[model samples]
Target: MWRRRAAVGVPLQEGKRVLSLLDDDGRGSHLFLLNVAQAGEAGLVGTVLAVEAAAHGHGDAPRFECKVSFDRRGTGWRQSSTFGVRSTNLSGGLPADGFAFVAPNPPPAAASVTITLFDISSGEPGSALRPVLPRSRRSRTRLSATTTAAAAVLLR
Candidate 1:
């Protein structure tokens, strides 16, 4: 069975946010979002609004694609980023479980974001995989601390 966790609505600065997708056996991949601030003082910064995964194709050769939507913070702009794992290579074979997160050519500004995990093989929306909020104050604190540390590192 495959299992995954997501951390959504994370607040980040003008840097990168790294998200890890973990399975039941503690195996998974990482997705990253790079945030870029506006130039000078006139343009609006770019921000990520949500991330979702869905199955592409409908037959035996279906593949997985991760979609990320951007929020220009009210700048009347719409941008999307996609990541995918091809089901077949030149050798006409399926590769092992693999994933990647490619940053947009021009990074967007920092903003709140949501991350999701889905299984492309199942061909069903994995709503059950949505992350549940930490129930305890300690858990929230720990998550915050970790996120802060990660942000610091990425901003450097």
Candidate 2:
């Protein structure tokens, strides 16, 4: 959930348009432009969509995707994103880059309007991926990447 703002944009080439967005408008400072079949007023909104896929990443690592979809014609439209997170090496950390694109105005899915962006992120790696301290400060927790084991430590 986020603030909704209208977009002010000018036309580019045929089927192409450019628009502006405010900070975190789509969850980041970037606004994605789409090529629409027909031109009209446009705006941007932010959302978080859970995208899970098989190991389609380099080294067969897991992917952590970030998405930014559009509400075209006031309906649900989107541009999907993909991610690659490898924590096998501690020095590498679980690095993740931003991705998501799922909006094409008009039919054919060839045209795009414009949309905002949200940031993408992943965490560091450690034992069982890593140990997370409970906010209650009463226990410590860990989750195995393989999901075969989970651990929790009670702290007093």
Q: List clash counts for every candidate, in order.
A: 1, 20
Please provide, for model 1 over 1-156, each residue's C-alpha lDDT reduced to its tens digit, 9 standing for 90 to 100: 333233445543355453444332345443323344444443324332112243232223433344444445556655555554343322422232343333333436542233333435456543122333346732653233222111111211
- TM-score to true structure, per model: 0.35, 0.21
Specify the highest-TM-score model's number: 1
Best by lDDT: 1
* Alpha-carbon shift of residue 37 in model 2 (angstroms): 13
Candidate 1 deviant stretches above 4 angstroms: 1-19, 22-63, 81-83, 86-115, 127-138, 141-156
Each model's lDDT? 0.36, 0.29
Model 2, runs deviating above 4 Å: 1-66, 74-102, 105-114, 122-156
